[model samples]
Each structure stands twice: as C-alpha cells, then as structure tokens.
Target: MAISKHIIITSLFISLLLLHPLVQAIDQEMTSNNRGGSSFAPKMNCGVACEARCRLSSRQNLCKRACGTCCSRCNCVPPGTSGNQELCPCYYTMTTHGGRRKCP
Candidate 1:
C-alpha cells in the first residue's frame, strides 16, 4: 500500500514537471501575440544614430558606413531612394562574420 502511494505521488510530480514547460510556452505565445511579436527592434523615430546602432556589429556597421561613404563620394544613391535618404540595402545586417554577405 505504501509503495502504491509513493508511485502515485511520484507520477503526479512527474506530470506536473512535464506540463510546466508547456504552460509557460503557452503564456509566452499569448504575450508575444498581444505585443508586437518581439521588442528587440530599434525604434524608427530615433533617425540616423539609431539606424547605425541597429547595425551594431563591426561587419554590419561596415556595410552601413560603406553605404554612407559611397553615397557621399559618388553623389549617387543606390537603387532605392526616398528623395535624399539612403535605404537599407541588406534584409538584415549580419553580425556573424563568417556567413554569406548580407542582403540589401
């Protein structure tokens, strides 16, 4: 009888442990859906400085700096332009150095 009680208690504890992660996952999903997915992105209102910050890593910032330099030196903008503003060429600037070149 004592063994059976111990087994039942252990089973309940194990089930709760397994379900805890699932419950947390559901809560996180709900919160993300309520918010705008992720808060990691930089606020657009900050303008140029913030734009440079978003491309934080050395390589990524390199591309950005290149764009700015290229624009000034050539006095010609890339394909996309909103009047005088230079557009982000890469899809997402890459911080990882060894990966393929970033998308524009």
Candidate 2:
C-alpha cells in the first residue's frame, strides 16, 4: 500500500508538469485571437487619411510620413487636420524618440 501511494503521487506530479507548457500555449493562442488575429485586422486607407490629416501642415512631406507610419501601426487616423486625438486612443498615445507626440 505504501509503495502504491508513492507511485500514484509521482504519476500525478509528472502529469501536471508535462501539462504546464500545453496549458501556457493554449492561453497564448487565446490572447492572440482576442487581440484580433493579425490576418483579420481591418485594413485602412492610410494614404487618403494621411493626406487629409497632413494637408495643413507647413512641413507637408514630414507630416505625411509621420501620419502614414502611425496609421499603419494603429490601423487608424483621428479625423481632422489637428486636435481631435480623442477619437483614436492608439494613434493618440504614440510618441517620438524625443518624447513628443508622434502621430499627426
């Protein structure tokens, strides 16, 4: 009886150890799916939106470049030429290396 009890406990402990990685992989997959599977994220027209947002900037080329980068990453562009950042949280929170707002 003592030897059988030891075997049962050892088997259960080994099984749990083996199952840990499989459980972690399933959790990671669920997390990725919940974030909108990359292949299924809605595509946005970055060109038109960037153009519209950067239209009034004195540095048109720079504005377009920055806006395009932000839109591509966030898949969004806040409407209007300026000051409506509340519309897109992802776009609004991006920052440059200098710690200034990066999104146009």
Candidate 3:
C-alpha cells in the first residue's frame, strides 16, 4: 500500500510539472526574437508583475519609443510609413499564416 501511495504521489508531481504553463512560457520567452535585447524585461519594466502576460501597448509613449528603436531589429515592418503601410498587413498576415518564414 505504501509503495502504491508513493507511486501515485510521484506520478502526480510529474504530471503537475508537465502541466505548468510557466514551463512553456519560459521556453517561449527565451526563444523570443524580440530585439529589445535580454537586458529589458517586461516584468521589471511593468512596475509589477502581471497575473497574465500581455504585450506592451503600442499606443503608450514608452512602447512607441521602444518600438521605434527595436522594430527594425524585429521581423515586423514599421507600423506607419508612406506607401508601405498598406503592404505591412499583407506581409504580416502571410508571414503568420505560413508560420515563421524568414523575414524579407
């Protein structure tokens, strides 16, 4: 009976570890190609940790400023530019729809 109980506990522990979202979140975060660099963390910059993860608001001055600096390093096209603005969505859509193609 004790052996069975220990096996149950061990299996439950391993199952919970596998189920934890943090595992995947951390993996995704580490692999992120965001070019703000490893120096900037959304956690440290957000003032407090958010219960759920979210992207920084593009409307915020900080995000806009950061994006202006960082977007060139990312695969994304700049949000506003003459002529290219219209093409940006199609580019993004195709890229997303196909899944992780090399940036132009």
Candidate 4:
C-alpha cells in the first residue's frame, strides 16, 4: 500500500511537470490573440514602393532616402511614380520644415 501510494503520487507529479509547458504555451497564445494577433509589426516591402516612387527623381539616392523615411513612419507609400498623395493621407499630409511635401 505504501509503495502504491508513492507510485500514484510520482505519476501525478510527472504528469503535472510535462503539462506545465503546454499550459504556458496556450496561455501565451490566448494573450497574443486578445492583443490582436502577433506583437510584431506587420511587414511592409519598402524597397518596391521606394523604387516605384523614386525612379523619376534626378537624385535617385536622395529620393530613396526620403521615401524610405516616410514609408517607415506612415507604413505606406502613395501608388505611381508621382502625384498620388491622395491615396495615402498620412504620407500626403507630412511636410518639411520649409512647408514642402516631405514624401515622394
């Protein structure tokens, strides 16, 4: 009887130990879902957007730099080579200290 009690207790202890990680994983998943899926920011392909916007610029390097900055901040870039700022209001509204449009 003594040995049987020890076996039962050990079995329960091992089962609980094995289940601990599973419980934690489920809890983490629930928390992440509650907070809107994953905690990481949504990936944006800035290279493609920058290329499209900056291709027409005489200073291609500077165009890319400015476009990248706006893209990172707004998480968006207006479509086309130029003149579609209406598509992205945030990108459109951003301006330089000199009162010029900051985004490409």
User: lDDT of each model, Cα atoms only?
Assistant: 0.50, 0.92, 0.44, 0.88
Error of 3 at 8 (Å): 2.3
* Per-residue lDDT over 1-104 for candidate 1, one digit per residue giving the tens place of the 0 to 100 score: 99999999999999999999999999998888668523544333323543444354456565556455443333333343222233442323432356853322
Better of 1 and 4 by TM-score: 4
Which lDDT tens digits does candidate 3 get at residues 1-104? Answer: 99999999999999999888878897787777465455453323221211111134434554344333333343344333222433445333333245743222
Instruction: Score candidate 1 by lDDT.
Output: 0.50
Better of 2 and 3 by lDDT: 2
- The residue-by-residue lDDT of candidate 2 on 4-87, one tens digit each, is 999999999999999999999999998898697466777899999999999999999999999999999988899889989979
Instruction: List model 4 lDDT by residue over 8-99, tens digit each.
Output: 99999999999999999999988887686234557578888899899989999999999999998888898888888898788999999999
Q: Can you give the lDDT of residue 23 in candidate 4? A: 100
Better of 3 and 4 by lDDT: 4
By TM-score rank, best first, the candidates go: 2, 4, 1, 3
Using TM-score as the measure, name the better of candidate 2 and candidate 3.
Answer: 2
Off by over 4 Å in 2: 1-39
TM-score per prediction, in order, is 0.35, 0.64, 0.23, 0.59
**In candidate 4, how many Å is residue 27 off?**
17
Query: Residue 71 deviation, candidate 1, in Å?
Result: 33
